[model samples]
Target: MTAETQLPQATGSCCSPGGACHDGADATTGGVTAVYRVTGMTCGHCEGAVAEELSGIEGVSSVKAVASTGQVTVVSEAPLPEEAVRAAVDEAGYAFAGRA
Candidate 1:
């Protein structure tokens, strides 16, 4: 599939007041939202690993990973410490490219 096709759309409606997704219910606090560039991810396995790792992070409520671009977008109910996110990526054997 094409790169565009490979990317998973953000789950639920994000910006609409009447959207299914609840606002701030699953979002990060401190006005901090991040899209991290995760390296060493080549396939579903990598994606799964990254997703799983991020899921365990405290305050991290949602994570969407795109393997083709090694990108992971995370949303949390509270501001997630960057160190925590970085550790997740590193522990998963992937390189963290900081916020993008």
Candidate 2:
């Protein structure tokens, strides 16, 4: 791998051509959203599991988990602390590969 190799910045979409994923955050509240690269989410149950765990965290307003894309968008009042997100993903029986 070259040192110049750079990962795409995390957005609502997972690196689409036009950068559109439609991961909606409540604009009225100006909620903060973070896209995480979650592993081992291959089914709806897996998505639900991850969402369920993440939703328990304080200040988390919503969670949209897409299994096929391996992207989990978490919407909260503010950018969530990494430790909180990491623990939630771990508790859900998945690997937390950090933000996208």
Candidate 3:
């Protein structure tokens, strides 16, 4: 099988990973989606690390990171309190460069 066929697809609700509900709309209570651009991301590993960091937040529903552009889109069950997101980025050794 090709690499594409070998990878397992992720299954998640609107609140789960890789779900399609990240347009500033709340996934849990149907609130709003929050998109942020992170800085200091340069590769797939950086994206993975950032995604992992965001995923650890309590209210974060999912994290999509595009390493090429250093962009990170996050969906939240509720409003993503800035401090929380910032903390995650900081812990991951990156800088949260506001929303893009």
Candidate 4:
């Protein structure tokens, strides 16, 4: 994975976590995928919010957040800086447990 420094603030909408319906017009627009363990996500709405924030990051191509599994997968052109992920999770009102 390559490196990505600063990330942009997230914008949101009512959307699913699947790479369909949102900033996910192209699943492979970016070439790298990362997974993180996010605590406090326990339902679809939680997943949606997390997905929104991650998908809004500049290099991100798609985002999949599974609240039941506490996993957030982010696809991007490069490996995102940990701080960026941390911020997105925070923006989504969750705790960043670390990479998965």
Clashes (backbone N, CA, C under 3 Å), per candidate, total: 2, 0, 6, 0
TM-score between model 3 and native:
0.70
Best by lDDT: 2
Candidate 1 clashing pairs, residues 3+ apart or interchain: 27-76, 28-76
In model 3, which regions exceed 4 Å deviation? 1-23, 26-31
TM-score of 2: 0.72
List runs of model 2 lying over 4 Å from the truth.
1-26
What lDDT score belongs to each candidate, Candidate 1 first? Answer: 0.67, 0.73, 0.69, 0.71
TM-score, per-candidate, Cα-based: 0.68, 0.72, 0.70, 0.70
Task: For residues 7-94, write the lDDT of model 1, one tens digit per residue.
Answer: 2224444554423234334221322345789888888878878888987887665577888887887766566788999999899899
Query: Per-residue alpha-carbon lDDT of model 2 for 59-82, expressed as tens digits?
Result: 876677888888887777777889
Q: Is candidate 2 or candidate 3 better by lDDT?
A: 2
In candidate 1, stretches whose alpha carbon ends up further than 4 angstroms from where it belongs are 1-32
Number of the candidate with higher lDDT, 1 or 2: 2
- Local lDDT at 57 for model 2: 88
lDDT of 1 at 56: 85
